[model samples]
Target: MTDLVVPAVINLDVPGPVISRHLYGHFAEHLGRCVYGGLYVGEDSDLPNAGGIRLDVVEALRALDVPNLRWPGGCFADEYHWMDGVGPRDRRPVMVNTHWGGVEESNHFGTHEFMALCELLGAEPYISGNVGSGTVREMSDWVEYLTRDGDSPMVRLRRANGREEPWRVKFWGLGNEAWGCGGHMRAEQYAAEARRFGTYCRDHGGNRLYRVAAGANGDDYAWTETLMKQLGDLGCAHRPAPFMQALSFHHYTVPGSWEDKGDATVFDTDDHYRTMVAAARVDELLTGHSNVMDCYDPGRNVGLVLDEWGTWWNVEPGTNPGFLYQQNTLRDALVAALHFDVFHRHADRLVMANIAQTVNVLQAVILTDPDTGALVLTPTYHVFEMNKGHQDAASLRVDLPAGLPSREVGRASLTTVSLSASRRDGRVLVSLSNLDAAEAVDVELDLRGGAVADVRARVLTAGRLQDHNTPAAPDVVAPRPHEVSATGSGLRVPLPAHSFVTVEGRLA
Candidate 1:
């Protein structure tokens, strides 16, 4: 062992912030096969489906206990027209999806179909409204159509489309990326539009809406500053206006520059180390935005929502460039664990977060093959399953001892080991990751303030960092039982190179 490596300590009795289950939220956009072929395979196909929505995908997401599903667009939300997708499927309008591959879109998976998918998964529906080219009336009418009742004009329109009852939608987004694809609007321009559009999205028939303003892009603090100053700040200290409850921003982990992101399955130890360096920027990004928010709204009344996040690599070869299909690797799993740890610590300010796309897209948990209808769970999926205990649990503080193992890349130096812990229902869960590419490291955990018993551990890793799953070999990078040894005052845990481990036990 190197002299720089040292032990760590965790105070389980001193529980910190409560991690929001909504932090484990997901996003499904209308680009490429994400909607048509990825989530919906039609009722006529041999695959199991209900009302043209695939059951296999629903069943998989249910296992994750998904909190919410954001739908209908990334950039596609700006140009989407809600009325064109309701009523009869055969009678719905067909339009071109100019943003993604310029492909023609059949308005088959509309509002009702999306609400049905949410029902099947037991997840909340977070619908992002059209703002770039849509009007105030269109946004207001869509809200009424989904939530209003008592024979209102929009309710009657919804009834003619065959839904007798209204759905209770809690989360609603005003727009997406107004600085770019949503529109070329300045920060001030988007804020004024958000204020006007949010005024008319009324709550009706007991359905309350949580209006989230589309916030900054990446590390654009000026954008965040503009929104905080202009919208909903009626000035009486901590209270923001009712129309705007939360604000959202986006960040993605790209291994290389945007012009040329490296391939998913082709990489080396150096690449793996460099990727961890890129992933560590998430902590700085969240802190930068949260600091700016604190200066304006000191009471933390307005919640920060990271609605779009995850890794983005180049599309697989021979695939459409806009489809965003990439293979998931062991490195991807570590990136997910690293991000969640930062999110757990920032729970006080950050209320919700959603990974980019759930199926057949960038950093997807489930990928459906084009040739065969077989579904493969990626390494990223196993990370979600292992860390599910952290959802809504009270986050525990984990800290490295002095002189802990550290590795330097560029101007950044990161600890070789990353750890996050939480307590819920008389049990404590600890998730640890080793970022060293070629060597195993031992972690000594000094457990304090609680009597623990029956500790169990599981690990997810592969022979190579780039190893991923396919239909032919599904269990290559899956989780299996790991070993944990007892120490005089605590426990000694050993983790392999490029691996993720989880330890769980009940409090006595």
Candidate 2:
């Protein structure tokens, strides 16, 4: 057998950007049961609920301190007409969600319901407007209805609909996938449309909206360059151009193409390794996109918003194909950890990232059974819970040892280990992920500016790569206490195979 490799050393130091808590955000689309059964069970249902939303899910999300929630659509947003969702629920219009499932939307869970949910979860509401199928007036009026406090036609309608106080909505997307589902518009065309629509998405009362342009999908560098260049030109001429607080980018980690996204829970070690490799590609995407953004806006005034991201696989068998629901397994937990690490490392450029999605949808953190009223937190959820301490913490510079081994599955390859570190509340927290399917890693930590006073760790791992929590066994992959010991000027810790670990220590 090959001799065990020397422990990898990581040197941690102070002085870095604070990881934005918004990076821990979530996405809720009107796809599958995500909005309906997943989040809303109706007020009259037998299941316990707050207003029309399920209380259990609310409490779980509240515990996560979910920073922000992007709503209404993936493709559904551009097709959505804000007017259809307001007013009396009984009188609301019903429309077909042709983009997601072919099911009819009751319109009961409209603007008010969404804002109410955001209020309940203590999360900022990020609304995506309709540019493909909606006019500028409609988008502007919708913003007015939600944020306006003074007398206005939209405010009057809001009051007539029973809401006396306006809701504070700060983040707004100009459109979703304008190059594709949103409308087959060219980058130049979409940029012009965004400018026109953003001109009317005015700040009302105390609410100042951060407008995000419809950005590139994956590594479509040209899309980012074109939009940024055009918008940059407009800014130079107009002084302060409309909207443009951020430019949105959507990337999902699928082993294969969209036509065959592979299975969620049935993958072997090879497939799992490939998935990890794909997830690591987010770093490349962010770097390329950021480089393009730098060329136009070298001052970095604008941020990058990863509005929609996460694993997308073939739907659970027998489920509606269009719903886009899939199981979350140990593999997903690693994928999440990988992305979170990347997001934290680049917190300076990233404003927010909404995992796609929250419940009963693609790589959801939580899953629910409508018939049995059962709820389960996936392995991905545990990763989020353990890493919550990193939110808003100062991201520390970590010097990882070079020459780490790279494991390969066919053409795909990934470093055996991934990590990120932060300092908060007089303590240093380090997150580590071991992507190897076999071989636990021995890691050494070198604390530069401070010494470790006390250390504690939490780890999420399972017996099998495919292990996941079903309703019958919800704690199958939950986090458990991990042991760490001081060694010389650092600490030594063992990271189990295919695991996500977070270690926290009081600094001296």
Candidate 3:
């Protein structure tokens, strides 16, 4: 028997308040079948829908307890014009989605459709403004059109468009990427441009805006440093010159070749370890970016919004590659858990995080078939559903020592068993994942101050390392509840290799 002794007790209370709910937010770009056949099919379709939004899909997302949904685009966000999506569907302009597949966008679903979808799912709407190919006045006008109520032209337009009320949108993205498709502007240039664009946005009564600036790409420390240095404190920067509340970051887990991003389902052991290492980079990026923010604002008021994240790979066979469509599997589930673990640990600084696309796109939670009118949930969807309890909870750090063995693949490998604990409503919930692809992990939970009775647990795993869920077999990878015990020293749980687990302990 291998002697795996309990490491030092992880005293998470040292820093205090580790988990934040906005970190659980999601994204929905108008790409591929994601918007067309995936989420919105119009009431005319054979499938049951409410206000043109898929009912089954809405119910599924509601079940997952999605906190927020970001709309328009990744690059598409920068090109979208709010006015084009409003008014009579027949009268709305028909434009080509140049950034995604060059498909025709009939403007069937616009601002009202998206906001209404958020209303149905009981999730907040995060609007991404056009910055790359839009003017300052255009973006500011969008804010007024959706938020302003009394006598503004935007409000009048909303009344003319058949929706007489305002959306009261709070979370607003200044732009997306900016370094890449968002304009390819230098850091200093984008900083100045951000200040210019953000200046005109108005804050309507009833809804306080949380303006998010487009942040750096993965591992781009210089980008974060430049923005923080140029813009100053973001969270507290309500001075109107450059009103900013959060900074945004985008990272996708991709293998060496962007063309051949390994395989979505069939992969060897090396690929398993490589995925973990790629997913784990999010933690380092967060840490490095936060340190840069610390240099600018030592008070730590500004927030880091991981607005776009998830696994990116070659499209599933027969799907549009540019659309970023891929199958979800147990491997994707582990990636989701790893990100949640990272977010939970840095909850205080990481205000909001959204998985790349919700449906029919990169790392989607739900997938649909237009011909068959079928709907299915993916393994990543199960991971999100199981971790809903972590929303808006205080993070309590668990003890994890270094020297934990990791698998290395081209300088990337799995290291330690990452865990994030939180306390909310008389319950302490811990979300953990073992990055190990081979060995089972022995975890000891030290719930000294908190009550530790009747620990209910849910886990997502599979028989094979490369196990995944396909349209043919959607339920293959899902969460199953089990009972876990608490001991005198702590709670001892054996985590299987390459698994995602969520444990809930009742507090007295």
Identify the candidate with maximal lDDT.
1
lDDT tens readout by residue for model 3, 1-508: 1245344254433436746677778889989989888889998988899889999999999998888999987899888888889888889999888988888889898999998999998999999999899999999888888888889888888888887778869988988999999999888888888877777877888878888889998888898888777655445442322477778888889865776887788788878777888888888889989988877766677788988899988887887766878878788888888889888878768888999889989889998976787888888899888888888877776765544555557855567477777777777777777777777776777666545677788888888767766668877888887555566856776677778788886775
TM-scores, all models, native as reference? 0.97, 0.96, 0.95
User: Which residue pairs of candidate 2 clash?
Assistant: none
Candidate 2 residue-pair clash tally = 0
Stretches of candidate 1 exceeding 4 Å from the true structure = 1-5, 231-236
lDDT of 2: 0.88
Relative to the true structure, candidate 3 has a C-alpha RMSD (angstroms) of 2.4
For candidate 2, the per-residue lDDT at 82 reads 86
Q: For all candidates, what are the clash counts?
A: 0, 0, 3
Candidate 1, 75: how far from true, in Å? Answer: 0.5
Q: Model 2, 20-134: lDDT tens per residue?
A: 9999999999999999998998999888988799899999998898999998978999889989988878999999998886889998899999998999999999999999999
Where does candidate 1 clash, by residue pair? none
lDDT of 3 at 454: 72
- Model 3 regions lying over 4 Å from their true place: 1-15, 233-242, 401-405, 410-413
